[model samples]
Target: MRARNLAVVLATIHRSGPHTRASLAERTGLTKTTVSSLVADLLEAGAVTESGAVRAGERGRPGVAVSLSGHRVAALGLEINIDYLAACVVDLTRTVRLRRIIPADNRNSDPAAILESLRALAKETTAEAAAAGLRVIGAALAVPGLVEGGMLRSAPHLGWRDVRVSDLVDMPFEVDNEANLAALGELWFGPRESDFLYVSGEIGIGAGLVVQGGVFKGTYGLAGELGHVVVVPDGPGCRCGGRGCLEVYAGQDALLGDLGSVRELVSRLESGDQAALEACRRAGHALGVALTSAVHLLDPGTIVLGGIFAPLFPWLAAPVSGGLGTRLAQMRGAPPDLVVSATGSDAAVLGAAGLVIQQIIAEPAKLLGL
Candidate 1:
């Protein structure tokens, strides 16, 4: 109970920003003495630190403000995409300290190697942070497929079944679908709009739907497979054995195939490349069209976009806005705000750390053995 109380305090501080002991006590319904004791324990554990003095009236002892000791708890997050393995190291507050990307070359045997590489990267980053006086506590891996019970039941692209992540991960690790983690990221760090669709346009498109501040994962893990939605039934073959999926139309390689280099393509688009502009417009149009369908069906309040393609975003707004037709776009009554993620490219890593925070906060006993 003591550990659990401290976890609750820590999680609350992380989500609601720095708060005073009185506020945490009131929020958690704990006694002031209990809150002080837990805070002291957390401070000693290096899980939290003092920010400054709070002047909420000098009626008593000056209240000392506290914030999460992010530097103390380094979390490594790995987003395992179809063709790439992106690893990131973040603190407890979801601030990414380091990130590295590796291309997944071989499909059949790359999963093991990729997992191993991510562990190694996490180790290296942890060592560096340790030299700088920080400690890494845990790691999280977000895969592009169904992950339930902390096991990859199936990844059609990676051709794996029941691949227990612990077989390759030697450190404390957690796993979940990339889209779900993205949704969690949006909920935690992006907008607190209560409802939003977090779309990830990467090598293959995926979505994370948040309704009323919680993820709607349906019965299966494939609930957010927006990429597999048929844009054109007879357009192009998709890796998911689908014909003319949205991913086939708007995925990374598809965007890069017609434009050559992805970096150059992004640069030219930013610098007013007609073709680049057109492609993004097309993608945005398609996404907006898809959002239109989603709006008609689910009626979400906001549609938040996050991923590598976030940089070349402003140009895609017109097509997306026009495609939505101004009705049920986003924000309910106002025009939809089709903007890139403010959390930058490390949202996934941050979200992964958020997952750990969430799990630990909800079930404090799990952190005991971990």
Candidate 2:
């Protein structure tokens, strides 16, 4: 009960901004004495700090405002994708203390080697965090595949199966799907939406479903495989052994084709290149088709275009809207608004770090060892 009360007090303050002991008690339905005691514990643990006193209206004694502290605690976020490895640290305030992205082609690469490099990168990032006076409480890793029970079940893009991440990295880390983490990232750091579907466009497309401010991982942790959703009956073969999958049309490689890079694609589109325009239109149409099913089933309030799609949203939005037009309007009266990710490609890694930070915020008593 004590631990739960402590968490309640902390969460209230975090959600409603700084609060005095009396206000925290009133808001939390705890006694003023208990609020004071918990506030003292939080102060001692460095999870929160009290600011200058302010009067609570015109009739009572002044009280100090208690808010989340920005020092001492932090977390590490790591990512292993088809073309890059990344490490980042976020403090209790969700501020990025350090970040490093190493560009590498991990397709068909040795998992052991890739993890070794990631470990090294994490080591370097943590060292830098230490210099910033932040103690990393825990770490989480994001991967472009299905993750269940802290094990990566499969990452077809990386050409691995049954790969155990713990064997490669010594740190005790939570493992999760990159798109799921990206969605959490968007929820925590982006527009702070209560419900949205974050579509991650990369070498392989994926999505993270956020509902009521929480990620819905679904049964078996395999819900957001938007890439393999068959958009065409027999459009083109996909690496997932499926025909006409959304990834075949909307993934980064599919959208880029001979353009080689996103930068080049952007350049070509700026010059009104017909091929680039056509490719985006096709990809957008496919995305809309896949998302139509998602909307009919899930009805997300917003669809956040993330990763490679953020940059291409201007050209893609109209086509996607067209594909979603008839069915969505008939079903829900209007389609959800499409928005670009504020964090861009950094969403997943930032979210990986955020997982640990949110834990600390939600249960500061654990960090206090109470």
Candidate 3:
């Protein structure tokens, strides 16, 4: 392996614990000499510095302590959903620093609008970071669509198909399905990014899945279309040419069908309006029904709730719990518990930011100037 690449591997081990050169070599499957060479490179690069000397209780020379430089890189994330767009700045650790959102109109079949918006938002986030003395290196955009090979497959609500985002957005930006980014955030924050499914309920519904730490994107980019999983064979027509799709009942518009807006609907539900309560229960039931199939197939450890509908989640908790309760009862145990995302709108944006960081880590060769 290249010494520079191996140097990163060594630094990672060092940050993880007090590892010896032998242990680093063993962990990375590199020769002792290779590890030593790489460690020397790291020392020279200033990406790693000896913290002090560790005195092992033995005859060996005192071990040198090392730590990562962690250059304080900042990233930006943007979430483009059905009716709104969210932007946020995050650190390499996926912590959101600040965020903003605006109403999005997906008309004219023009992805250009989104491109312009992303550039402006990214610039704004960079300026904000600079003012705060932060250095931003990359950005990630999350969209409610199937993303494949730098292209958007088709977002039924966004009314865009086969669009190339790489050509549209500016430098150091990567785009992916919004749910996937949510899953990333959840994975890092959840008990762990284990075999789990993430359900994001907003103006539209989408899913992100992680079987292990890695995301499982099916043959096409639209593998985990859990939201579109039919809850009822003939419940209602969905824009995606399906009947009883969960989105028709649990999506943002579903909660706002006859209301002023989703925010007001949340308030009504909060007040326990019998009508609003019923609607929330129905939405929950539909969500549970769709989830039943996924739970059966994936058997995820947990399900995460996010987006506009998160606050109304408590209203639907009973139905969701009941649905999962009855299903899991067949296997003899309590139902899987649900988690409301504390990240809210910022989650998706930060998820997008995580994408860029993940990319740079996965392919360091693409990373310039250390």
Candidate 4:
């Protein structure tokens, strides 16, 4: 009961910003005495701090403002993309303290070697976080594949199947799909929307469904396989053994391969290259078709284009919107709001950190344990 009250007070302050003891009591429905006790405990634990006093009115004395401390508890976020390995440390205030990304092609590479590299990176990140006076309570890995029971079921891009991530990382950690984590990151740290479809456009296309602030993983933890959705029944073959999958048209390789490199492609697009514009248009249309299916089935409130899609949103938005507007115009007042991710490509990594922060929020005693 005491631990629960402590969490309530902390979460209240976290959500509402600086709050006085009396205000916290009113918000939490706890007595002022209990709120004071909990706030004291949090202050001692370094989980929260007291700011300067806030004047209530002309009659009453100023009350001390209490807010979450940014220097203490932290979580380590890790990501393993086909082209890069990234790590970030985020505090309770959602401030990123340290981040590092290394370019590496993990596709067809030995899993053991990849794990060793990640371990080294994790060790370095943890040390740096500790030096910053932050305790990393937990770690999470965002993989570009299907994760079930802490094991990667399959990553067509990485060519990894049935690999146990726990065996690879010695520390206590949680594993999840990169797209799912990116959705959670956006939910927890970005717009704070309750329902949305987060599409990740990387080397492959994937999506994560956020329903009421929770990721809706299907029964097999493969709920949002947007990349595999068949947009063209008899189109080009996909790496996933499917014809005309969304990834075939919109994925990084498909869109950028013919142009030589991402830099060259972006330069050409800026220069009004007809081919580049045409490619983006086609990719946007494919994305719209897949997203239309998503909307019809789930009817989410918003659609977030994340990962590499964010950078290309300027060129992709019009086509995507045109397709969705034409298809869904019959049913609703307006098509769902399509927005680029605020975190850009960093969403997955930050979302991995959010996994740790979520556990601590759910059980404040975990902070005591740390």
Candidate 5:
């Protein structure tokens, strides 16, 4: 019961920011003595700290304001994308202390070699965090594939299958889908929306459904397979053995192949290149078609475009919104809000860090060796 109270006090402070003991007591519905005791315990645990005094409107003595001590505990977030390996360290306050991304073509490289490189990156990130007076409590690996029980079941983009995360990296870590991690990152660090569909565009497309501020991973941890959703009948072949999949139309590779590089694509779009405009419009239309199904099924309050999609959102939003608005106009009075991801390319890595942050928050006693 004490631990639960401590958690409540800590959570209240975390969500509502720095608070006086009296305010915390009022907010948590706990006695002033209980709140003071819990706050003292939390301060001793280094989970929180006194952030000076809060003025009492010219009435009495000032009360000390307590805030979370983010630097006391940090977590490492590592990501393996088809074209790059990245790492980031984040503290309890969701502040990124250090981050590095090395571009590598993982599609053709051996998985073992890739893991070695990622391990090196992890070591470097940990060293940097240590230098900054932060301790890494845990690490999580974000992969562009299906993850189950810390094992990667399949990554068609990387041609890897049935690989345990332990075998790939010597360090203890959790594994998760990149899109799912991105969704979690957005939820924890962005606007804190309770429900949304996060669509991540990269070499391939994927989506993560966030319901009530939690990721809905489904029965087999494969709920949001937005990439494989068919946008056109017999349109194009996808790497996933499907025709007319959304990825085939709106993925980075497809867009790059059609319009050269992203820089060039954006340039052309800005210059009113007819071909670029047409391509974006088509991609947007296809994305809209796919999201229409998602909207109908999940009925999320918001749809966030993330990853590579974030940069190109300016071009894609109108068409995608048009598609969704057209398709869902009859069913719902208002279409779900469409927004670009605030985390952008960093969403997965930040989410990876958040996984550990969340664990620590749920079990603050761990920090005290209790």
Candidate 6:
């Protein structure tokens, strides 16, 4: 009973900002004494801190306001993509204290080598976090593939299958799909919409369905494989053994081609290069075609373009909106609003760290070792 009440008090403060013990008691239906005791526990655990006084009510004396703190408690987020590896540390206040991204072509590489590199990156990040006086509570890894039970089921782009991540990393880590983590990142740190479909356009495209501010993994935790959605019935072959998939047209590789980088594509598009413009148009149209099925099936209130798509949104949004408008015109309402991700390419890694932050918030006592 005390444990549940402690969570109640801490959660109330976390959700509603600072609160006095009297106010917390009123909000949580607990006695003032109980609220004070719980707040003491939270303060002792470094999970919260008291600030200037606030009036409990119109007739009562001012009481000290308790707010969520724990500046020293942090979470680590890691990501492994086809072309890069990323790591970040987020403190309890949701501030990103440290970040690093290393460019690497990981396609068709040995999973052991990749994991070893990631382990080294993680160690470096944690060391930096410690130097900054932050204690990392836990970690979460985001990979561009199907992840389940801490095992990577398949990553066709990386030529990996059945890789147990736990065997490689020696830490408290949670594994999840990168797109899904990106959606969660957007939810906690971006537009913060309650419901949306997040499309991550990278070398290998993926999508995450955010329903009610939570990821909606399908029955097999394999939902939102938007990259493999057939946009062209007989277009081109995909690494996933699919034909005419959205990735073939809308993925970063498809858009960049031999350009070497997105900046090159952007420069060309700015110069009114007909080829670059045509490529973006094709990718946008393909994305629209893929999202159409997604919208009709899920009916999300918004759609977010993330990863490489974020930088290209200014050029891509119009074509995607046009395609959706043309297709869903007969419906009762307009198509979902499309927006660029706030964190852009950093969404997945940020979300990976956020998972640990959320766990800490959900159970503040864990930090107290209770």
C-alpha displacement of 151 in model 3, angstroms? 1.5
Please give the clash total of every predicted structure, in order: 0, 0, 0, 0, 0, 0
> Can you tell me which runs of candidate 6 are displaced by over 4 Å?
167-170
lDDT per residue as tens, model 1, 60-101 = 666788787865666666777666667766666666677787
Q: What is the number of residue pairs that collide in model 4?
A: 0
Greater TM-score among 5 and 6 belongs to 6
lDDT of 3: 0.71
Please identify model 5 stretches exceeding 4 Å from their true place: 29-34, 55-60, 167-172, 258-260, 367-370
- TM-score, every prediction: 0.85, 0.95, 0.84, 0.94, 0.92, 0.96
RMSD for all candidates, in order, please.
3.3, 1.7, 3.4, 1.9, 2.3, 1.4
Error of 2 at 369 (Å): 3.0
* Deviation in Å, model 6, residue 292 alpha carbon: 1.0
Residue pairs whose backbone atoms clash in candidate 5: none
Q: Which residue pairs clash in candidate 2?
A: none
Once model 5 is optimally superposed onto the true structure by TM-score, how far is the C-alpha of residue 97 displaced, in angstroms? Answer: 1.5
Model 3 lDDT tens row, 1-370 = 4735654564465347456565566677778797777667655643444556775446668767554434455667777776667777765445567778888676445787777886777678788987875567677778888788778877767888888887544567677888878877676544553566778887678787877676788877777777788988978788778898998888877777789677788788778778888888899898888888877787777777777657777887778878888887777476566777666666677677777666544544344243
Please give the lDDT score at residue 236 for candidate 2: 84
In terms of lDDT, the poorest run of 10 residues in model 6 is: 361-370
- Which ranges of candidate 1 are over 4 A from the true structure? 15-27, 56-58, 103-109, 159-161, 191-193, 258-260, 270-275, 326-335, 361-370
lDDT of 4 by residue, 1-370 (tens): 9988888888888778698888888789999999988888888877888999996445578899999888888889999998889999999888899999999989887888898899899999999999889888789999998888999999878989988887545555899999999999998889755788999999888898988778999998889889889999999998878899999999999889666566687788899999999999999999999999999999988899998888889999999999999999998858899999988889999999998887777777665552
**Positional deviation of 51 in candidate 5, in angstroms?**
1.8
- State how far residue 55 of model 4 sits from its true place (Å): 4.1
Tens-digit per-residue lDDT, 241-322, candidate 6:
8799999999888999899999899999999999999999999999999999988888888999999999899899999999
Ten contiguous residues with the weakest lDDT in model 5: 164-173
